[model samples]
Target: MESLEHLTPTDREILNKSWAIVSKDMQQVAVNIFQMIFEQAPDAKLMFSFMMKDYNVTDQDTKTRIVT
Candidate 1:
Protein backbone atom coordinates (compact mmCIF):
# COMPACT_ATOMS: atom_id res chain seq x y z
CA MET A 1 0.00 0.00 0.00
CA GLU A 2 2.79 2.44 0.87
CA SER A 3 4.67 1.61 -2.38
CA LEU A 4 1.61 2.43 -4.45
CA GLU A 5 1.50 5.94 -2.93
CA HIS A 6 5.06 6.58 -4.19
CA LEU A 7 4.33 5.70 -7.85
CA THR A 8 5.43 8.53 -10.19
CA PRO A 9 3.14 10.03 -12.83
CA THR A 10 4.88 8.02 -15.53
CA ASP A 11 4.33 4.80 -13.65
CA ARG A 12 0.63 5.56 -13.30
CA GLU A 13 0.32 6.37 -16.99
CA ILE A 14 2.06 3.13 -18.02
CA LEU A 15 -0.11 1.07 -15.71
CA ASN A 16 -3.28 2.66 -17.03
CA LYS A 17 -2.18 2.14 -20.67
CA SER A 18 -1.30 -1.50 -20.05
CA TRP A 19 -4.67 -2.10 -18.36
CA ALA A 20 -6.52 -0.60 -21.33
CA ILE A 21 -4.69 -2.89 -23.80
CA VAL A 22 -5.36 -6.04 -21.76
CA SER A 23 -9.04 -5.07 -21.22
CA LYS A 24 -9.63 -4.66 -24.93
CA ASP A 25 -8.07 -8.07 -25.67
CA MET A 26 -10.22 -9.68 -23.00
CA GLN A 27 -13.37 -8.25 -24.57
CA GLN A 28 -12.70 -9.93 -27.92
CA VAL A 29 -11.83 -13.19 -26.18
CA ALA A 30 -15.19 -13.15 -24.39
CA VAL A 31 -17.10 -12.67 -27.64
CA ASN A 32 -15.22 -15.54 -29.25
CA ILE A 33 -16.03 -17.72 -26.24
CA PHE A 34 -19.75 -17.01 -26.56
CA GLN A 35 -19.65 -17.69 -30.30
CA MET A 36 -17.95 -21.03 -29.62
CA ILE A 37 -20.52 -21.90 -26.99
CA PHE A 38 -23.41 -21.33 -29.36
CA GLU A 39 -21.65 -23.08 -32.20
CA GLN A 40 -20.60 -26.19 -30.32
CA ALA A 41 -23.88 -26.59 -28.47
CA PRO A 42 -26.39 -25.08 -30.87
CA ASP A 43 -29.29 -26.18 -28.74
CA ALA A 44 -27.83 -24.29 -25.74
CA LYS A 45 -29.05 -21.04 -27.28
CA LEU A 46 -32.58 -21.93 -26.20
CA MET A 47 -31.49 -21.76 -22.54
CA PHE A 48 -31.28 -18.00 -22.77
CA SER A 49 -34.74 -16.53 -23.27
CA PHE A 50 -33.26 -13.03 -23.46
CA MET A 51 -31.71 -13.06 -26.95
CA MET A 52 -33.70 -11.55 -29.83
CA LYS A 53 -35.46 -13.90 -32.24
CA ASP A 54 -36.91 -13.53 -35.75
CA TYR A 55 -40.22 -11.81 -36.52
CA ASN A 56 -42.48 -14.24 -34.71
CA VAL A 57 -43.61 -15.36 -31.23
CA THR A 58 -43.41 -12.92 -28.28
CA ASP A 59 -40.07 -11.70 -26.78
CA GLN A 60 -39.03 -8.74 -28.93
CA ASP A 61 -35.72 -7.47 -27.58
CA THR A 62 -33.52 -7.07 -30.63
CA LYS A 63 -30.15 -7.23 -28.92
CA THR A 64 -27.59 -10.00 -28.42
CA ARG A 65 -26.57 -10.64 -24.82
CA ILE A 66 -23.04 -9.58 -23.92
CA VAL A 67 -21.27 -10.17 -20.65
CA THR A 68 -19.86 -6.97 -19.24
Candidate 2:
Protein backbone atom coordinates (compact mmCIF):
# COMPACT_ATOMS: atom_id res chain seq x y z
CA MET A 1 0.00 0.00 0.00
CA GLU A 2 1.68 3.15 -1.22
CA SER A 3 1.13 6.31 0.79
CA LEU A 4 0.88 9.91 -0.46
CA GLU A 5 3.90 10.78 1.65
CA HIS A 6 6.16 9.44 -1.10
CA LEU A 7 4.99 11.92 -3.71
CA THR A 8 7.79 14.14 -5.00
CA PRO A 9 7.48 17.94 -4.86
CA THR A 10 6.54 18.14 -8.53
CA ASP A 11 4.01 15.36 -8.11
CA ARG A 12 2.48 17.16 -5.15
CA GLU A 13 2.26 20.38 -7.15
CA ILE A 14 0.48 18.66 -10.00
CA LEU A 15 -1.91 17.01 -7.57
CA ASN A 16 -2.62 20.34 -5.94
CA LYS A 17 -3.38 21.87 -9.33
CA SER A 18 -5.68 19.00 -10.17
CA TRP A 19 -7.48 19.37 -6.86
CA ALA A 20 -8.00 23.06 -7.44
CA ILE A 21 -9.43 22.56 -10.89
CA VAL A 22 -11.65 19.65 -9.98
CA SER A 23 -12.77 20.72 -6.53
CA LYS A 24 -16.27 21.55 -7.76
CA ASP A 25 -16.76 18.13 -9.35
CA MET A 26 -14.86 15.86 -7.01
CA GLN A 27 -16.71 12.72 -8.03
CA GLN A 28 -15.49 13.19 -11.57
CA VAL A 29 -12.03 13.82 -10.25
CA ALA A 30 -12.17 10.63 -8.23
CA VAL A 31 -13.22 8.70 -11.28
CA ASN A 32 -10.32 10.14 -13.23
CA ILE A 33 -7.93 9.40 -10.41
CA PHE A 34 -9.17 5.85 -10.21
CA GLN A 35 -8.57 5.37 -13.90
CA MET A 36 -5.12 6.87 -13.65
CA ILE A 37 -4.25 4.70 -10.68
CA PHE A 38 -5.49 1.61 -12.44
CA GLU A 39 -3.35 2.42 -15.43
CA GLN A 40 -0.29 2.98 -13.26
CA ALA A 41 -0.93 0.23 -10.73
CA PRO A 42 -3.63 -2.21 -11.75
CA ASP A 43 -3.55 -3.85 -8.34
CA ALA A 44 -4.34 -0.69 -6.46
CA LYS A 45 -7.92 -0.19 -7.63
CA LEU A 46 -9.43 -1.82 -4.57
CA MET A 47 -7.22 0.17 -2.27
CA PHE A 48 -8.21 3.41 -4.00
CA SER A 49 -11.88 2.55 -3.70
CA PHE A 50 -11.54 1.74 -0.02
CA MET A 51 -9.70 4.98 0.62
CA MET A 52 -12.27 6.98 -1.32
CA LYS A 53 -15.41 5.37 0.04
CA ASP A 54 -15.41 7.47 3.17
CA TYR A 55 -15.38 10.66 1.12
CA ASN A 56 -18.98 10.10 -0.01
CA VAL A 57 -18.04 10.86 -3.60
CA THR A 58 -20.79 10.05 -6.05
CA ASP A 59 -20.50 9.02 -9.69
CA GLN A 60 -20.75 11.86 -12.14
CA ASP A 61 -24.24 12.34 -13.54
CA THR A 62 -24.38 12.03 -17.30
CA LYS A 63 -27.06 14.64 -17.66
CA THR A 64 -26.10 18.08 -16.52
CA ARG A 65 -27.63 21.35 -17.71
CA ILE A 66 -25.06 23.89 -18.79
CA VAL A 67 -25.78 27.58 -19.23
CA THR A 68 -23.64 29.59 -21.63
Candidate 1 local Cα displacement, residue 57, angstroms? 7.0
For residue 65, give model 2's deviation from the true position in Å. 45
Tell me the TM-score of model 2: 0.37
Worst 10 residues of 2 by lDDT: 59-68
Candidate 2 contains a number of clashing pairs equal to 0
lDDT of 2 by residue, 1-68 (tens): 38888999999999999878889898988889878987898546445556554344334576433221
In the predicted model 1, the residue pairs found to clash are: none
* Tens digit of per-residue lDDT, candidate 1, span 1-68: 99989999999999999888868789787888889998898657667777526213343497544331
Clashing pairs in 2: none
RMSD of each: 10.4, 14.3
lDDT of each: 0.73, 0.69
Off by over 4 Å in 2: 1-20, 46-68
Residue 36 lDDT (model 2):
96
* Residue 28 local lDDT, model 2: 89
